[model samples]
Target: MLYWFFTNPVSLSRWADKHAEGRKLFFKCLYLFTAFLGIAVAASGAVESALAWMPRSWVRYDEDGESEWIASSIAHVAGFIVAFFVTLKGAELATRIRRLEEESN
Candidate 1:
């Protein structure tokens, strides 16, 4: 896993090279990657901000007599879920890139 982690840039470079060298739909794919990354960052940042603010007691709590802020908690988890999908999208992109790299080799 660590090895794979370290080698990601090489794969990314090759993928970018393929795109730069006249592959069609390059901008389309790049736009999707940018959008996904933007969404992932926004979602994760919102979750982090919410969790950080929770300690200040500014979050709303459910009226069921528990101190747990149920709605905010759910939102945090949903934010992470959205971020996780973006990560999965990245993995899928890497796999497709690797396949294309292999095919070209």
Candidate 2:
């Protein structure tokens, strides 16, 4: 399996350099995608935080919020896990882009 999440900055730099040019549309699209993922990560985190603080009664489906809590909690955790990798990816891509820019100088 390609453990892209485990790749080092050097590998990321190499990948960026291999992408035809330093500032191609691919890079632009990647940057934009990471930016959006950042927003989603933030939103997911906020939702988790809010849910944590809110009263259990807010869900209002069952007498107890157990089911809703479990579902939302699972979703929140999943969101965080995904966010962790994507955040790393974004940072890696940004570092690679910077490396490419430096190399072109």
Candidate 3:
């Protein structure tokens, strides 16, 4: 697998064609995970922020407003994951299209 990544451009396409379907599925799963985690983290942040704004006298709580950092970190990681998968999948699609065009020609 590492070799596949290190190969030249022509070799890369050959390698990709051999594992096209598997790679596609892998990237799709990665993309989905990123999306899911991002949403979850953002939701948690929103909830935490809401809680922080709530009247402390009515309901005593121990959570600090530091959850914003957690949310921001998650957002950054999720964004990277999302971007990686999007580019990977787009390359896969472009390769598939190019192959099909070549075959038709």
Best by lDDT: 1
Cα error of candidate 2 at position 66, Å: 7.6
Per-prediction TM-score? 0.42, 0.40, 0.37
The collision pairs in model 3 are none
In candidate 1, what are the lDDT values of residues 1-105, reduced to their tens digit? 334323353444455566566753464355446656666668866776666645546555557766765446656667768966875676577668868878999
Full candidate order by lDDT, most accurate first: 1, 2, 3
Clash pairs, candidate 1, are none
| Model 1 per-residue lDDT at 32 | 48
Q: How does candidate 2 fare on TM-score?
A: 0.40
TM-score, candidate number 3: 0.37
lDDT of 3 by residue, 1-105 (tens): 645443223345555567785685555444445545555566656555645544434432336733243434444565566556655665577567767867999
Task: Tell me which of candidates 2 and 3 scores higher on TM-score.
Answer: 2
Top-TM-score candidate index: 1
Model 3 alpha-carbon miss at residue 47, Å:
14
Q: Model 1: how far is 43 from its true place, Å?
A: 3.1
Cα shift from native, residue 32, model 3 (Å):
20
Worst 10 residues of 3 by lDDT: 65-74
How many clashes would you count in candidate 3? 0
